[model samples]
Target: MFKQKKQQELREICKSRGVSLTPQRQAVMRALAARRDHPTADQLYEDLCRQMPGMSRTTVYRVLETFEKLGLVRKVDSRASKAHYDADTTLHPHLVCLNCGKVVDYQDREFGHLEPPVFTDDGFQIVDYAVTLVGFCRQCRQDPNN
Candidate 1:
């Protein structure tokens, strides 16, 4: 249901923005929306390639870039070197596991709420922001080797 809603939202957004809803774009969005975990483009490509034999890594990277520009997704910040994407673009905090490189939405929405001034002292406009909390996840903490 969540994936369907996101796909519909993507369609509406594409239509409004005068962008063609290409198959690659649709596939990328569907794959991203289907997951709760924030995945890197390479990870997405691996999953997609099994289903879409012809899909390329470059295409996934490009489509994700387009989606980010179109406000269909958000790039999540994590300790990992590769970029991670989240389909849920709303303002919310993320809990990043330092040990396993896992990123998940922080369950408590009210915890990190913030309202910044429109302009900073240097006259830089504050358009957006993200809050990420880093720590070891339960599994990682319980693991003997980690």
Candidate 2:
């Protein structure tokens, strides 16, 4: 149901923006929405390759970039070198595992509420923000090797 809603939202957004809702774009959106865990472009491409035999990694990367620009998805911040993506665009906290590079939404949305001024003393605008709490996940903490 969540994936379906996101897909529909994508359609509406593309229509309003005068962008073509390409099959590759829809597939990328669906794949991202379907996963609960934040995944890198490579991970998404791997999953998509199975469903879309001829899909290329470059295509997935490009599609994700477009989605991010369209505000249909968000690029999550993590310690990992690779970029992680989240389908949910709402401002919220995330729990990032330093050991395994796992990124999960912090269940409590009110944990790090902030009200920043529109412009700083230097005239730098505050358009967006992210709150990420770093720590080892339950599994990583339990496993000695992790």
Q: Pick the candidate with the highest lDDT.
A: 2
Candidate 1 lDDT, tens digit per residue, 31-80? 99988899999999999999999999999999999999998999998878
Model 1 misplacement above 4 A: 144-146
| lDDT score for residue 4 of model 2 | 95
lDDT of each: 0.93, 0.94
Which pairs, if any, clash in model 1? Answer: none
TM-score of each prediction: 0.93, 0.94
Question: Taking the tens digit of each residue's C-alpha lDDT, what string does model 2 give over 9-46?
Answer: 99999999999999999999999999989999999999
Stretches off by above 4 angstroms in model 2 are none
**10 residues in a row with least lDDT, candidate 1:** 137-146
TM match of model 2 to true structure? 0.94
